[model samples]
Target: MNWLNYSEACARNQAVILAELQPLLATTTRVLEIGSGSGQHAVHFAAALPHLRWQPTDLAAHLPDLGANLLRFGSDNIDPPLALDVTQEPWPAGPVDAIYTANTLHIMGWPQAVALLQGAGRLLEPGGLLCIYGPFRYAGRYTSASNAEFDRWLQQRDPCSAIRDVEAIRDQAHACGFALERDISMPANNQLLVWRKAV
Candidate 1:
């Protein structure tokens, strides 16, 4: 058990995220999680949602720790972690009933964010859900002062990384054949945005 790979943020929010996902994913069979990070959410969610096969993925660089964490605490429903860099490639997984990612969009550059949406559109089955959890700007307005400060910190850390606008993401998702279904408020000024693929 490598405590170093643990994420306090993931620990704090996984239960809340699960509460929203449980009912939405009741009928879903396979879930592909992008940017699985330390695998905390994967292990936790897979354990809670035993019926869904959870596939965790991250960039190659993060795979060692991701895989390690999954192996350490993952259940039978959780698949071995795969290497996925949203900006490129075969995605390394079969088609899934749903896609989930947390706090990933703001960490990726704009091009990468676009790629993720496009890829999610390609990978999910019709009527499948694409659930994204993170802070986002709406109509060019920040939701809170803390989120604004967080956005600034992110930009300072990496100019390419900043909070994305919800409208921009919705537009891209629409172009990719997805329809916005829900925008649920979450803790820490973040939101859980749900989109469903057009059937």
Candidate 2:
């Protein structure tokens, strides 16, 4: 039997994410995708953005499924999956053109999330783009009732996991020498935040 991890939400969101990624990634040659869950986006984006070499990374446990997905649908542009834990140092030694992470922060503890941002800062070259996609609270308030409920659910499931505020995220990103360049409102109350590494 063929085995590959699947995520309905990933399938649903990949297109919108790709639309946002295209222009942001147009000038990029190397991209590192953090938390490549299910590898759905890796396959889809690699097929669409053939010019970039997409490096997918995640915790070791997910490597098999991620690798399987890559073997199944990945093209030449998609590199083999790499083991990455944000809290651990030396993020694959990248001076990449772009860094992309989707639906990851809210699921991790805040400290790890901050570490991820810091690592992104170190990974990107000057003027590189950092794209983060997920629901975010604005001005300390949830954007929608559904997002509020989702935050509650996330906290209930894992105390460390909850929606992050745009303000807090900005502060963290700013500390890493990144500046918010674009904030695209995406479907399902999520936001695609683009931060540019200072040149």
Candidate 3:
């Protein structure tokens, strides 16, 4: 039987995410996608935004499924999946017009999340964009009861993983030479945050 990985969340959110990313990335040429789980978003975004050369990456273990998904359904604009652990040094790709990641921060431990932001700072040029899509807490408050439940579930699954605080992330990104440009609300109690590196 043929098998390929899939993410129901990715399937649900790709359209709305694309609506936000389409204009933000219109003038851009390349995009580096961190934690390209199942390669679903990569395929969807690449197919929609053909102007972008999309580089999808994830942990080594996920590469097989990710690569298979990309090979089977990805567009020419989509590159093969690469191994990328946020804590590791020397990311596989170079400077790009923008960096994108979805539903990743809350899955990573705090240190890894910090490292991912730092790595984006290093790889992106001044004025480049870093677009992140995920759930976040504002002023230590969850946007909805469902998000609170999700946080509890996440912590139960992995003690170090829970919805991150927007203020803390903003402060950290600022320290890394990025300024929060936009924080747009999305469906399912999620957010699409855009940051731009100092020019």
Candidate 4:
């Protein structure tokens, strides 16, 4: 029962992610974080924004590692890890005011990624915010040569895992009761896409 993992990238980018989410989550009472891997962002964000409750979730197999990380760095505002698989019918009970997930889309297949958006559509309250952070291609082109290499590396590991298209995600968001709000540039060729659940 030793579940421990470390993600240096999560530590490095936690601040940037928090800065992006601060204003967006200002009035949000509850926020659900999908793929809360290592729980680093969960602890950092929850500690910084004490007003909002942070609910961390991941696949059942990933829960223990997340739980272990939370135990070391968690704040009072964060909740226990919940099991969440995007393809599973009926996501965890919620009408959450905000959702935050990082580096998840490219890791999951296209269909699973779509399911994630669809599940977020169902769980989010009207006007709720969903912030997705990852590398994305635009118009079938990679943003940078490094990104192209990264995509190749990803596909080599798992064919289904590769950077997604921005337009495709935008279209799926529209279908899932979301309206594109902002697309922010981030460090290391990553992008943060924000969408709001239409009222």
TM-score of 2: 0.97
Q: Please give the RMSD to the true structure for each candidate, in Å.
A: 0.8, 1.1, 1.1, 1.7
For model 1, the stretches where C-alpha displacement exceeds 4 angstroms are none
lDDT of 4 by residue, 1-199 (tens): 3326778888889899889889888899999999998888898999999999999999999887788888877899998899999899888858799999999999999999999999999989999999999899999999999999999999999999989999999999999999999999999889999999999
**lDDT score for candidate 4 against the true structure:** 0.91
Better of 1 and 4 by TM-score: 1
Return the candidate ranking by TM-score, descending: 1, 3, 2, 4
Estimated TM-score per prediction? 0.98, 0.97, 0.98, 0.97
Mind giving the per-residue lDDT tens digits that candidate 2 earns over 74-181? 899999999999989887747688999999999999999999999998888999999999999998899899999999999999999999999999999999999999
lDDT (Cα, tens digit) per residue for candidate 1, span 102-175? 99999999999999999999898999999999999989999999999999999999999999999999999999
On the 0 to 100 scale, the lDDT of residue 136 in model 3 is 98
**In angstroms, how far off is 123's CA in candidate 4?**
0.9
User: Which residue pairs come into collision in candidate 3?
Assistant: none
| Candidate 3 whole-model C-alpha lDDT, 0 to 1 | 0.93
The segments of candidate 3 whose C-alpha lies over 4 angstroms from its true place after superposition are 1-3
Off by over 4 Å in 4: 1-3
In order, candidate lDDTs are: 0.93, 0.91, 0.93, 0.91
